[model samples]
Target: MRNLKYYFAIFSIFIMISCGENAEKKVEEKSKEETQIETEAKVSEKNVILFFGNSLTAGMGLEASEAFPVLIQNRLDSLNYNYEVVNAGLSGETTASGKNRINWVLNQDVDVFVLELGANDGLRGIPIAETRKNLQDIISTVKEKNPNTKIVLAGMQIPPNMGEEYTTDFRNIFPELAEENNVELIPFLLEGVAGDPELNQQDGIHPTAEGYEIVADNVWSVLEDVVEKE
Candidate 1:
């Protein structure tokens, strides 16, 4: 009877020890999971800046790094701003196509949206009203997706090959949209680089890598205000 009692006591202690170890291990695992979750949350907390446009924004004929959007990203990183820039530019994309893809591009949250379309539309001589409506729909879709997303319209200008009246109407589109939507505007996206032989690539449309530096500056001027305010 004494031996049996001693064995029973020993067995109880072994079970208690096993349960204590299991409990401790579970607690440690839970702590690790919580830490991992917090780390992921921190990573996801970074804001996003989406640049939606055409070949210019896509940096056609230049490396992805030479694109103004990437340059903007590098500048943001240098300033230690926690924003991720998504270069959603597609070569040859017009405002109509942009409107079609805006919803898909906006799958993730966007803090700042830079609209750089309609240049192709102007170049192609698409009707001013159609371009305007497409852009308005795009803007409306963006606002509907997230009302707080700040938008910046990158104004563009084309030569008079499409007629001076058409040119004037296209030029007027950007500021009008900006005023109507109450969004920020970059007066002219190509500013210093446009029509400058040295600044352009062979196509005379897209900027050279060197010219992209100026383009980045043009964007940053207005972008700085928008981001700093945030």
Candidate 2:
């Protein structure tokens, strides 16, 4: 009887230990699942920025990842802000082209827009009236779809050879559209770098990497009002 009692106590202890081991494993598995959920949430906490422009915004001479939109993303990262910038630039696209595709562009879940069209139109000496009308339509469409969306219009310049009067009309288009639409205005997309030969690529049109830096800087000062990086 004494031997039987001793063996029963030993078995009870072994059963208790096994149950404890099982409970510990369950706790560990739940902890791992919680950790994974937190990681995914952290990765998704960022605003979306969309850049709609021509070859300049496309970073024609640069790699895909080195575009101005990507540069802005890098800047935001350095500032410890969470945001995603998408480049939707198409080479040789004019204001008319942008107008046609504006609806499709707004389909994304973008919180902000960098409007940089009309450069090709000005370069091609297209009618300023047509350019202005097309841009106005795009602005209206965007405002209709996402009323809270912030727009930053990138202004362009026409060659002086086109005569001062025509150039004046071309330059007026951007500011007029921006003011009418109640949006931010980037005085010149390539300010501090446009006319400089060293800043430009071989085409004397597109900016080099350094030039894009200046472009991003010009846009950065006013970008805060448009996008709140968190």
User: Clash number for every model?
Assistant: 0, 0
Task: Please give, for residues 55-134, the per-residue lDDT of candidate 1 as tens digits.
Answer: 99999999999999999999998998878899999999999999888989998889999999999999899999999999
| Model 2: worst 10 consecutive residues (lDDT sum) | 1-10
lDDT of 1 at 56: 95
Candidate 1 residue pairs in backbone clash: none
Task: For each candidate in the order shown, give its overall lDDT on alpha carbons.
Answer: 0.90, 0.82
The alpha-carbon deviation from the true structure for residue 89 of candidate 2, after best TM-score superposition, in angstroms, is 0.7
Write one digit per residue (lDDT tens) for candidate 2, span 22-83. Answer: 57776566556555655655666567788998999899978887678888889888887777
Q: List RMSD in Å for every model shown.
A: 11.3, 12.4
TM-score of 2: 0.84
The candidate 1 region of ten consecutive residues with least summed lDDT is 1-10
All candidates' TM-scores? 0.85, 0.84
